[model samples]
Target chain A: MLELFQGPLFISILAAMVRIATPLLFSAMGELVTQRAGIWNISVEGTMLLGAVVAYVIASSTGSPWLALLVAVLACALLSLILSFVTIVLKSEQFIAGLALNLLASGLTLFWFQTYIIGRDPPKFAGFEAVEIPYLSDIPVLGTVLFSQRVLTYVSFLLPLAVWFFLYRTRYGLEVRCVGENPKALDVKGLSVGGRQCLAIMFGSVMSGFGGAFLMLGYSDRFVPDLIAGRGWLVVVAIIAGNWMPFRVVGAIFIFALLEAIGIHAQVVGVSIPHHVFLVLPYVASLVLLAGLRSRTHQPVALGIPYRRE
Target chain B: MAKAFSSLIVGAFGSQKALLGSLAKATPLLLVGLGTVIAFRAKIWNIGQEGQVLAGAMCAYWASLWIGPLPYLIAVAVLVLAGLAGGGVLGLLAGVLKTRFGTSEIISTVMLNYIVIFLLAYLLDGGPWMESGATVAYHQSPPVNAMLEWPTLFGQGAAKLHFGFILALGATALSALLLERTPLGYEIRAFGSNPTALRFRGTDISRLLLVVMLVSGALAGLAGAGELFGTSHRLRAETLLGIGSSGIVVAMVGGLRPSGAMLAALFFGALKSGAIYMRLQSGTPAGLVSAMEGLVLLFFLCAAVATRVHITVRSEAHA
Candidate 1:
């Protein structure tokens, strides 16, 4: 156990935690916006998955990781448009709509992958490579752990702050927040509640797409079915655990990522515990955290409720 | 595309074998769908049916092992009961959390699915329940005693269909009756549509929620037992995990009605059955079937919403 915490091992674990947390951070920040705007977009898992597959397909075919990332975000934006229409325009139940979208994404990705790449050696591209900052990279522990990550990792670290500023510092952000807490007030103010919600949903989905792209282009070499796993759901949990706060949501994501890193490293180090037990550690931790912390966290008043003009 | 579509239709209904195969597939979906409908009717989102099914399967498997020496009919009955208890307990836990801790059933249920799946993996992967044969893989659980297996209801070979299909059909009728003819059924629907009103009338909402969870979980458990005794004969993750989610789609497509769920299950089951044939003959991937299911679910949700809402288009010039 003591050896497990030595200099190199500790730094490696910390680095792994950051990398693992990137996808979660991206999606959680996006979800934080959506939840803040009074919509619980449960389709984050599905949207992230769709983004991952699209990223993989585009990256392998075009050999441009940047273009793949862009396409991923745009494609998911379209997907979230469907969610927005259903939840906002049609006034459907958000949870069920999200579940339907999740299934759709899961099925669509698998079908596309099987139809196009099942038998062949699926094409692979060199994904995003890490960029080193000159002086920062020279710093011993922090350099290797934080400064030498992929460009996306650096963006992920800064995204929560950007979201924080956007939510707290902007007039539109205030309106969006109000749309969730009391859409009636916004409606009475002659503002379009549905329009604000639509933007929030789209923004959240674009972020989810970025997270999915990072998972494929920045983390893995190839795409697989169910590649996004449950990271999208973890993002939801983080939002709940963080009480819809940007910085605390990032903290929750880091804790989850830490558990995930431990799970991976435990297998690498041949820990005596059952591998499945370790695999489930993050989910168990999330449940425990949510159970304990949710009571203290105040969800938006209109979250999951469809707004009406009446 | 036309040829493939024709082949799918013919493959799903061309022969008795194909028909029975579809029925076999539909059995689990129907059972789980019934469970979902019951819970959804009460406005309870018990999305952890996947885990509850696994819990039931694991318990049924254990019960079969211990009761192997008993009379064949008695052993099967005991195994089914064990399955019900196993799944019901997990559902009850979620109910307790919701009533006591104010946890969202959706999140709690999803988390429970992961936890139960991991527990199943742990038990199967070189754990005590793993098959002991030299050639057997870690994932394979030991087959239940022969006496615990359900008797076949059709042609003897690969086309054989088990009696569990009858139980599924029976459950659909039973659930329909429970929802329409009983006071409890009335209360369930009332709770779904207006819980605050029910509370005003002095209804025990928490107790009602617990009962709904128990019944829903028991039906899902029955599905697990049916799969174990009728088809797989051994508990495995691949055989169980997707059933719960598919059941959710089935229930929604059925509009949360027992009779509707039964019909939807049969349709989806035919799609699943035909997808296998399509894969073998046309080289279309089996994943297409799942995609189709999702597409059907999305269409149904849209249709449901369209019926409930009145839409109007206005020019932006009005602003």
Candidate 2:
């Protein structure tokens, strides 16, 4: 075990962990903002799927990763806008509508990916590259693990801080939180609840889309149907685990990534646990974390309820 | 009534084999859908129906492999039992977590799905569940004993329709009985509508969630058995992909009604089976009908949302 923690493999695992955490960070930030505006936005997975497909298509077609990423973010924003239209403006059951959107995203992406690519996996272009600062890459163990990765990895780290600033330190942020906590009070204050929620959904979509783009561009480098693979839901879990705070969300992502990393390591090393025990690790961990946090944390009073002005 | 009748006639018996194929495919979805309805009614979101289905299929396949020379009736019973146990245990774990830890059923069930997929993948790839020395690029276990399979209703040469259809119908009836005729069902409905109220009344929402999840999972598990015994007769990794999400669709479309689930499941089964047939017939790209499936869901969501909007407006007007 000491040997396992002492060297390059440790650095590799840390780097991989950050990469894994990037999507969750994007999604958690998105979810936090949405919740802050009083919407659950369960369509995070569907939006991310759409973003991945659109990003992969754009990048593969134009061979411009940056342009591809922009398009993906826009696609997710559009998806959020639609969700906002139905749930916020139309006053729908956010949960059911979100689930339907997710199903639609999955079906549509699978259909197109299957159609265009036939049987082969979707094509990939050069994805976003990692940046090395002049002196940062030379630091010892921490340097290799933390400083070395794709741009999205660093962006993921920066995003939480950005989210924290926007959420707690800004006027718009305060308004959003107020709206979430008590929409009627905010309505009395003359803030448009629907407008704020729609904005939050858009903000969340940007992060989710970035996360989706990262899945194809940064992690796997090719789009597969069902590419997000429950990461969207995991992001929601991270939001709750982090107590809806941006920085704390990283810890939740770390716990999940760590569980997954350990499971992969065990399998790679051929450790003889009953295969089912190892298979169920992350889910068990998530359940435990969720249970532990349930009592201690305070969720927004209006988290999943749709808001309409009387 | 007349419109529904026309659609039903066209949908069910537009052709000879169409009705049979539709029913055959509907069996698994109907079972899974009814189970989902049970959980949904209890406010326990058990989305791992596909995993339960796969687990049931694997258990049944495994049972048939080992329980050789047993009477056909006994073998079939063991297969169904094994499926129920495997799925029930998985559901029980989810239920416990939801009850004890306050974890969201949605997240737990989704993650459990991945675990099931990768676990099955591992089994077929090289682990204990693999059939040995397979030449096919894909990994799958051997077919179950032919004698253990369900018999066809119409004729020997009829397409793959079998007793699983009847089993699914029976499950639907049981689901209705469970929800409507029993005190337990009353508690499930009450708990689902208001868990906090149930807690105040000392009804134990956690226990209810757990029981409902287990029962739901067991039903989904039996669906897997039906799929195996009725048609494919083998457990393949290919079956798990879309079935779970489709169950959600069925549950929603049914308005969480047990009989409605049976109907919705039949519709989806036909959609799926017919989509393939239409694809093969039309030479429309294989993905076209899938795209239609996605489009239909999207429209369905829009309609639901629109309805909500109308209700809110009406209530506001009255208020």
Give one digit per residue, the lDDT tens place, for model 1 in A72-152.
Answer: 999999998899988998888899989989888888777788889888898978689999988999999999999999999
What TM-score would each prediction reach against the true structure? 0.96, 0.91
- Residue A179 of model 1, lDDT score: 91
Per-residue CA lDDT of candidate 2, range A1-310, in tens? 3444656767776777777788878888888888878887788888888888888889899999889999999988888877887777767667777777787787777667666886665575878887765578789877777787777788788888888898899999998998888999988977788888889989988888998998888877566786787788878878887787777778888888776666556666666665556556766677667878874355788888776556
Which 10 residues in a row give candidate 2 chain A its minimum summed lDDT?
A1-10
Superposed Cα deviation of residue A239, candidate 1 (Å): 0.9
Quote model 1's TM-score. 0.96
lDDT of 1 at A279: 85
- With candidate 2 superimposed using the best TM-score fit, by how many Å does residue B299's alpha carbon deviate from the native? 3.2
Model 1 bad stretches (over 4 Å)? B133-138, B309-319
Off by over 4 Å in 2: A1-3, A120-124, A259-281, A308-310, B1-14, B155-158, B196-202, B285-294, B305-319
User: How would you encode candidate 2's per-residue C-alpha lDDT over B224-307 as one tens digit per residue?
Assistant: 877777777667878655676677778778879988888888888777666655555543443443455555655676777677
